[model samples]
Target: MELFVDLQIASENQADLPSLTLIEQWVCIAIDAGSSKTRKEAELTVRIVDSEESQQLNGDFRAKYKPTNVLSFPFQNPPGITLPLLGDLVICKQVVEKEAMEQNKSLNAHWAHMLIHGTLHLLGYDHIIEEDAVEMESLETKLVLQLGFPAPYNEQE
Candidate 1:
């Protein structure tokens, strides 16, 4: 799968994260897990927006007033065809940084986790239910490990 990542850092905070290549690697792993082998050559965009913009989107679409670390807007296009346009992943830079610091994780690791999480959402994965959450988190953990990061849920336990 050919992955294209467009990262935009709106925050002025100085935190050195992984390069785009690493992001693409994590995204590809997530996408590969969520999609079938037949459905290849997909395109998706990932933008790192600010907390204010994330709050606006969360309020508008999710009906929540607070800013989220990541939001996925999947393209509900027609099914059963070639060359799929997955959708977009919007990541709140400020929220991610704050969450990372609060969770006692490195910025790069958190960034990879969030990006992988959002990309999975784009591919129609969700953690709304307990079973689904387990499935999603399992897949995320594997992909994150492949990206050289620790399990995202390890800190929670």
Candidate 2:
């Protein structure tokens, strides 16, 4: 499977942000692990934004007033049309750094988890229901662990 990512950095703060290569690797891991069939090519965009944009988008789309770590916007293809376009992911760099410090997880690990989580959402995996959450988390954990990162759902004390 071939994956193409258009990484856009709109955030001024790039402290702990992952490189495009790293981001692509993490996204590919999720796609390979989640997809059932092999594809010739896939395309998506990853946008890194600061808190203000994140908060605005979160409030507008999710009804949440606070900035979120990541937001997944899956592309909906038209009827009788098929394309390699997967969707887009907007990641809040500040929120991710804050969450990583608060959660006591490595910055790279958290970044990987966020990308994997967002990619799963693009693949139609959701956590609104308990069963679905479990399945999604299980897949995320497996993929994260395979990347040598701690299980994302396992909160450290």
Candidate 3:
């Protein structure tokens, strides 16, 4: 899989973040892990924002009022349009940082999990159902592990 990412940093507090190239590699690894059978070019946008922006977007798009870690907006290209665009991932810096600290995980590791999670969602993976959740989580574990990161759902990570 070939993946291209357009990164946007809307967070005012320019905290340290993984390089854009690294993020692109992570996303490609995730997409490949989830759909190795297909050969396609993928494009996506990754936006890093503050909690307030996350909250507003969550409320507007997901009907939730609170800020979450990551939100995926899969593109809705019409029936005939054949753009390789996958979707947009809106990530909250503050929430991710807090969650990592509270969960006793490294920021980079947690970010890797979020990136994989969101990218999988873009690749048509859903976790709302128990079985699907297990499948998606399993794939995430494998992908992150390949990158030398621990399984996200494992407590010992």
Question: Model 3, which residues run further than 4 Å from truth?
Answer: 155-157
Best by lDDT: 2
Which runs in model 1 stand beyond 4 Å of their true positions?
Answer: 8-17, 79-82, 155-157
Alpha carbon lDDT at 81, candidate 1: 58
Better of 2 and 3 by TM-score: 2
User: What's each prediction's TM-score?
Assistant: 0.87, 0.96, 0.94
Q: For model 2, state the Cα shift of residue 66 in Å.
A: 0.9
lDDT of candidate 1 at residue 51, scale 0 to 100: 80
Clashing pairs in 2: none
Error (Å) of candidate 3 at residue 132 is 0.5
> Which tens-of-lDDT digit does each residue in 1-157 have in candidate 1?
6666666666555466567787787788778887755454777777777788899999999999999999998888767755567888888888888888888888888988998899889888899999999999998888888878777886464
Indicate the TM-score of model 1. Answer: 0.87
- Model 3 Cα lDDT, one tens digit per residue, 107-148: 899999999999999889998999999899999998888889
Candidate 2 or 1, higher TM-score:
2
* Distance from true location, Cα of 109 in model 2, Å: 0.1
- Residues 1-157, candidate 2: write the lDDT tens digits: 7899999999997766799999999999999988877778889999999999999999999999999999999999999999989899999999999999998899999999999999999989999999999999999999999999988886442
Better lDDT candidate (1, 2) = 2
- Candidate achieving higher lDDT, 2 or 3: 2
